[model samples]
Target: MSLPPTFDPVRALSLARETLSIEATAVNAMADRMDDSFARAVALVLGSSGRVVVMGMGKSGHVGRKIAATLASTGTPAMFVHPAEASHGDLGMITAADVVLGISNSGESEELTAILPLIKRMGVPLVALTGRVQSTLGRHAAVVLDASVEKEACPHNLAPTASTTAQLAMGDALAVALLDARGFKADDFARSHPGGALGRKLLTHVSDVMRSGDGVPRVRLDADLMTLMREISAKGLGMSAIVDGEGAVLGVFTDGDLRRLIEKSGSSVDLRALTAREVMHPNPRTVRADALAVEAADLMESNRVTSLLVVDDAGSLTGALNSNDLMRAKVI
Candidate 1:
């Protein structure tokens, strides 16, 4: 659709919508195209003891890399090897135990077509994702997935737009199906992505990030004002955990508590006589050392506290941490 000489935001928006609708239609068409081929491809990857080796070139290579990453991060062990690179002594990466997934919009990339026979000769199962099922790569594949598209989102319809999108969607579908077959969970995903936010939320325990042993600011319940002040100052957490003789956390005394005590006592109050149990906030919020660090962060935020005392199941102090600790660990 062409706009008139006059500028019109509505007309421009309509053209954008038309592009999206065309791509969406392409993806929907692929749903009906799914048949025994997709099933066979899934079975090949799932049953393989080795990895799912994905091969592609150009834009298909970009999509293939992401598909390989998704599959590996999910439950399937997958890797991407460029077809051109594979022909140049990289074919050794594939073995008889592995299954090869080749992606090409036209199914006739000379590089991919050239390597199919070698991969097959090695007794590796070949699965092809292509727009043309009759092309050379498709003809050589044991399983042919029809990743056809009606049109490209590009105005000239020359670029691989909708076709690449279909390939990506189909790859994601296959990965998720294998993930379900293996009963992959959030914890399993986190194991593969330990540095990501989701991994921190699911895998980083309090003990992994909290200050332990002497690093924790702790004082006995019978400790005097001077002792509590020194522990809090030395820890620089603006707080101290008050524990019983057995190391069980009894209460928490923060800078806020000191301010409140000063307000109530005014001048001429005896600081030397004060004890942790007298001014400390008893039964302070606590988290287990083995708990997720994200859980500790949530506890601190909800309680409006800067630090928390880490405890074991037996209610003994094991560690301590403040908001800064969570921030340092990138758990905040």
Candidate 2:
């Protein structure tokens, strides 16, 4: 059968605009309603020495998982326990040291309510995020976080649209508050997300991925040009450092320098008599071994080079890291 052409586009657009406006207003209302109870909920989770167990049913459970993830990543240890699973022995996961955060817009989900008594019996501090302050779960909870909204964004007023959004926003608020309260920093966050780019940027050090010792292409300042060429060819770094008797990096001879030297004095000239100090570029770009790999990559990119010399606090050569090393570390 052919689709009807008489569908009202104007009415559909009007309803869409009305729903968006209503949801926007509802979120603003929820933000305005945040009070001391919200603070209490955050404090309860923060003070708990054990994990925060979040439990709910349906959409609330889905929102609870996201809340638990946010809390866990932001330094507040948290995990989600499905209400149905809690009744089927998962409740054992809840302990007296844990703080139970229960989410239910109606505050009367049977599956969620069924395990409430057990949570209470375990002496777990209860923090409820619900629309009704007088609801059973809210009344039983040690802290009642009001996530009430005026109406559902759904046209039929049945789907959990506005309520879930409000719940998610409230969860974010709690996570951020706890993050700031606990002084959680980016480095701490990186530790939890070690596989992510942020971890590569923050946790990686120059020494961790750098080429070091004999693997670092280098030559004594008095070495002949031919010997320097041999060092560069064998090391595969396309450049060789010129060093003093004490092993201090004096300068560098690079592929670009070789090109220039060839152009100025014919490549056929005997290079053995030439000293490394005569052809090496003095004071090459360097980075401390402990510096972040991101910084090293930035230095290499800014200076228009492919590699960086890694040095100790006293300016002694510790290693050498190239752009490829940063790529391998995922710092790029």
Candidate 3:
């Protein structure tokens, strides 16, 4: 490849802006063109007993893959099958229980149109995403979604730029409508994306990332200040929970309290005279073990504390966790 003799930055920037504007206009026009056909397409997918088998060719195939992925992650079962491959043996993947979503900007792609008759004969509902509803692919469809674009973003008006954008926007609209109809919530989305950040936040619980048993730093109420500090340092949680004889949390002594006590008392105060009960902050923030880890992070941020006491429903100290623990679990 050779560089252009003279690179015109002005022309390049102008074309880039024009391309974005055209695609934006195409997608906006699709939103305005949404009609009963779009709703019927959503209904067809919802009514299907199996998955949504999305088929497209060329650039439309790329958009179909993305649409299928979005639909599958958002509570709708969907998969993308290449049009040309479907003509070979991939059509066996489709069944009567599934719905076919065919994409063709011209509604005349030989690969896609070749399988339209076979798909129809299978008694499967065909939802067409095409520019020409009167073409072969659209005429044989049970529901036709108009994805027509005024023009392509390409300067020569040959590439599949604006038309592909319209198809993508229409696919997203269908997925969102079906998601709402199925009552798909954030938790449902998280379940599908277990390795994602949202999944970590919604699925991780306090107990899953908390320090339990001897791992928790705790000192008796009557324990000396030195014992409390030792426990805090030993556990590396920056704080020590003061518990009663029944192992119930009474208060918490944090490193902040220690600094304040030393600053107020100066060098004249006897450090050995202090007890856990005297220096501990009463009613420290607590979280239940069953609560979400993200909830613990929010509680820490709102209270401006780095550590929290994980307790049972009966108010007994069951575990302990700090901001570091949540971060380690990737729940922050």
Candidate 4:
């Protein structure tokens, strides 16, 4: 691949800036031109009981796939079907209960237009995202969304640049409107994207990541400092809970407390003779096992602590967690 003989750095930069300006203008113009048609389109899909079937060709088809994904993730059920493939028996994917969203800058792609009559025969409502509202695709649609652009960002004005931008912006507008109407929330979006970070934060609970049973580091309130230190070392949590006979957390002691204790007492006091209750920090922050993992992170952060005692409704210690546990779960 060789640079064109006419390629100048200054010219390239200017052209890039002009391209962005043209696309931005196209989107802004579309926003200003929005009318009741946009709302009606939203209402049309909302009223439907079936999924939205999206279809397009070429670059428009690529944009259609993205729109479908965005809609699905945002609570609207949608999928994209290739227009050319629809001609070869893929039209069976459409159902009378579904709404078809057709995308084309010209509104006259042969592959797309060829299926308009079949879609009409099936009685599936059509929503057109096109530059020309009077073209064949628009004429067959029950609701028409004008995604028209004044000109292409391409210097030749033949490529699909600003036109495609307009279509994408219009698609996003429709998805957002539908999402709001449906009362879609972050949790709903996370459900569709369970592999993403938001899902982990919203869906993962403290019990899922906390150390349970013997994994929890704890010592009786009457235990000596040596026993407490041994428990903390074995669990490797940097801390041990001071629990009563019934397993209720009374207090906690960490390596930091040990260092501070040694610094304050020096060799003047016998540190080995101290009891867990006497050395532990009372009223340590605790989190409910049912709480979200992100909530635990927030509690730890606000309290300037790296660990938390997991308790049940009765305040009985059920488990424990540290910053390392959260990091391992990717919830931090």
Go through the candidates in order and give the clash count of each.
0, 0, 0, 0
lDDT of 3: 0.94
Full-model lDDT for every candidate: 0.90, 0.88, 0.94, 0.95
Ranking by lDDT: 4, 3, 1, 2
* Residue-level lDDT tens digits of model 3 in 1-332: 97697888899999999999999999988888788888888888989899999999999999999999999999999999998998889999999999999999999999999998899899999999999999999999999999999999999999999999999998898999999999999999999988999999999999899999999999998899999999999999999999999989999999999999999999898988899989988888999999999999999999899999999977899999999999999998
- Look at candidate 4 and tell me the lDDT of residue 132: 97
Q: What does the lDDT read for residue 53 in candidate 2? A: 91
How does model 4 score by TM-score? Answer: 0.98
Model 2 lDDT per residue over 250-303, tens place? 898898888888888886776667889899899999999888889999999899
Weakest lDDT window of 10 consecutive positions for candidate 2: 265-274
Ten residues in a row with the worst lDDT in model 3? 30-39
Please state the error at residue 168 of candidate 4 in Å: 0.4
lDDT of 1 at 268: 84
lDDT of 4 at 271: 90
lDDT of 4 by residue, 113-134 (tens): 9999999999999999999999
How much is the lDDT of residue 26 in candidate 4? 96
* TM-score of candidate 1 versus the correct structure, residues matched by position: 0.90
In candidate 3, the residue pairs with backbone N, CA or C atoms under 3 Å apart (3 or more residues apart, or in different chains) clash, namely none
Task: Give the root-mean-square deviation of each candidate in angstroms.
Answer: 3.2, 2.7, 1.4, 1.0
TM-score of each: 0.90, 0.91, 0.97, 0.98
Best by TM-score: 4
Relative to the true structure, candidate 1 has a C-alpha RMSD (angstroms) of: 3.2
